[model samples]
Target: MTAPVLEMRSIVKTFPGVRALSDVSLTVAPGEVHAICGENGAGKSTLMKVLSGVHPYGSYEGEILFEGSPCAFRDIRASEAQGIVIIHQELALIPYLSIAENIFLGNEHATRGFINWNDTLRHAASLLKRVGLDEHPQTRVADIGVGKQQLVEIAKALAKRVKLLILDEPTAALNDGDSAQLLRLIGELKEQGITSIIISHKLNEIAEVADSVTILRDGRTIETLDVKAGSTTEDRIIRGMVGRDLDHRFPERTPYEGDPGAHPALEVRDWTVHHPIDQQRKVVDGVSVQVRRGEIVGIAGLMGAGRTELAMSVFGRSYGRNISGTVLKDGREIGTRTVPEAVAHGIAYVTEDRKQYGLNLIDTIGRNITLSALSKVARRGVVDEHEETRVAESYRGSMNIKAPTVFEQVGRLSGGNQQKVVLSKWIFAGPDVLILDEPTRGIDVGAKYEIYTVIDRLAAEGKAVIFISSELPELLGMCDRVYTMAAGRLTGEIPRAEATQEVLMRHMTKNTR
Candidate 1:
């Protein structure tokens, strides 16, 4: 029998007032794709962090063995020195730097205290080619799309001569084509005798590429299953992570009564938004959409299809330039030219990039939750701290935000919990129309169901919801009606009964110039 490449035994890591990991163990064989499956806050990422020395040696109690040798790494650089490279969920490349520069930022091609540009670009070009990224090494990283950025991240890892490559939510920001290319690259790397440990919530991707699967729940190792033995089904893995079989992926919603056209809760007409920098380029071309009271409408499209642009433009002219749109609420025109006006007009938008645009990372959960509507918790023009706490506590309970207290920092919470806080903030604002953009992105299956349930409940409460997602099944499962977009144009609209992956793909790829 071949010896294991990596082994982590009895790892325990903790934060203030929270135990992130507890006596968790993982084993990875040489040249095998190992997958770590878990729900949000399950310590999947924490375990990898410990292995990569992000937590250091003394910060966590654990025994790590690499290539049958006991290892004690103090920092990320120490781990990288031993051919262990970790690509975090958030890509670490600097946007302003060139691709080659970003790839070898810290590990530069230098000789005798002098940098070698020739060797750097040459090696970066080769690495980019190996990763199937067809781009000039000197190209500015900011100019490229997210899919390319992901490739750049991999190329960066490969530059380190990585033996045990660790990727956390690598495909979270990628579209289908990009995701497929990434997975194929992983397979190629496996063939080359490189071991990989991938941590992701996308179970299909896990089932597709993983050789062995380790399940973690609430800071403990549940079990590890061998994929080749036909034991790692998506549902089975989900059951292990969530500790129960999820009978339904999405919550059932009561059908909206009456003709949807009879009472349009929110409507956008002749909406066209130009690119922010490139004024002549229209990101969101002449498009119009309507949502009725008590209806959950969905926008399904590929990356760069302008779904987010459309929603942002409609919400508060948040994106794009040269915007021309008329927003109507209950047959009355409303001014949504600014964020404050949009909110006052009963329109709330939950952004896809929660860490970036959704929440104040340094602030408390209570503060972030009540940020959108402070007036409700204010008295005599003074912010009432007790009322704010009460309101935030109410949302924390209803939204299922898993935090010890409302005083916990928002950044300290998991992706799903942070998302719930974002939802809570907007819902507290008491909006008649809510726009949820990739609300469940990077979240686990269990959290997704909760988010879906919240959306359904909002629709039931007579709130019009415009749900935008890149996942076709999510759209088909939770949406009452799904609209497809391509090239900034509405391609097709399919009702729940008529929607399928095949049909949605057809419309999503439709050339609607």
Candidate 2:
């Protein structure tokens, strides 16, 4: 009925040797919650970048009509000036700064360039309240949980007087409770007449709150459906995303058939690790785990239940201090005191934070894939570029990484492809044991199935896998055996036949001496 709030007419964006977006069009109504769904590399992020001016005006060919006026934004600042703010999946808040300080970091409350702290905190308190966060304004951002940090990010957007807010994978890292809270907040924001365009792989969330759904597939807009019209279900969205019906969320995995009495590929005994900063707090306490050859073992726990801490600490003591652990390979104690030693001991860890810990974003895909095992391609003291190229190319083909070439920058790849690159790096290292933490966190259903296929292949090749995931269904689907962790202790170990959400939850929350 009313004129659309935003409209993009025939948008096209391209990178070297790659057409990221091709003649994409979008329309968003005023004060409506719109959802953008796509498989990785589907040009969803590129379209958003075009609108937010991250791609800028001259970099792409498009006509952007905002509130019935054709406008060209030269940069992100220009878009923000027109009350459009985009929040990335990776939050942009300074950890060490106070919440108030972070909210008003760039746009400060000041008189003649001198910041007025009293006014800043007073205003920040109101914004925090508006977002339903009860924390004090002076509380350090690092001290709070990730959900609160997300709220702080929104408060920062409000500081700029944002009218249109764009969130990319807003709940990718949040737990169930936090995700529910954030969704509720979105509903509240909608009631306040702030339009939101959410880009997420979580279809359930989209179905729950979206007024309209737009699906993209391989650099093109497939279709847009009105969610209130009762035909835009999650399955419908998936079909549009992948161009086919996905009957199952995960690939069918055959039961693992391996010698149970044989020594495990990797084992940890009585592992204990103190917090990196607080030595008195035991982040991982006397935990033991084992993974047999040709088997996928899972670790399940709540957000603060020490699943990630245990995995990181055991992987070359990478996470904690005052660590005491006994690591064994094939029934013999092996020294994994450092990262290099861990790799040498036939162990690899694909970190959960792929951007921060896994891949080198600025480097070429060829370089990133070969980085973990450079010695394999190195001749004498110098690296053989030819050998490196061959290895990277082989992995690029095997992993099905959607890039123009191996020379493409890894940062340019989509979330799923970037994950594939991270996996390729570790697989090239020839590890006997692989620790995958949240391997499919933000990827789509189709991409998730592909990753699951990769994991199955690794197990079939006789490599042990320690899979850690927040989703209980993932654990039940992929793991041959699942171990439950609670308060840094192992509570229960359930086989695939016996593992259920109810059983896992009981163990995940139980207290053990």
Q: Write the per-residue lDDT of candidate 1 for residues 1-513, one digit (tens) a residue.
A: 999999999999999999999999999999999999899999988899899999899999879999999989999999999999999999998999999999999999999989899999999999999999999999999999988998898899899999999999999999999999999999999998899999999999988999989999999999999987886689999999999999999887776674745748888888999999989888888888988988889999988899999999887899889999788999999899899999999999999999999999999999998899888888888899999999999999999999999999999999999999999999999999999999999999999999999999999988999999999889888888988899898888898889999999999999875
TM-score of 2: 0.98
Instruction: State how far residue 505 of model 2 sits from its true place (Å).
Output: 1.9
Task: Note the Cα lDDT for every prediction shown.
Answer: 0.92, 0.93
- Tell me how many clashing residue pairs each candidate has: 0, 0
For residue 133, give model 2's deviation from the true position in Å: 1.1
Off-target runs (Cα >4 Å) in candidate 1 are 259-261
TM-score to native of every candidate shown: 0.98, 0.98
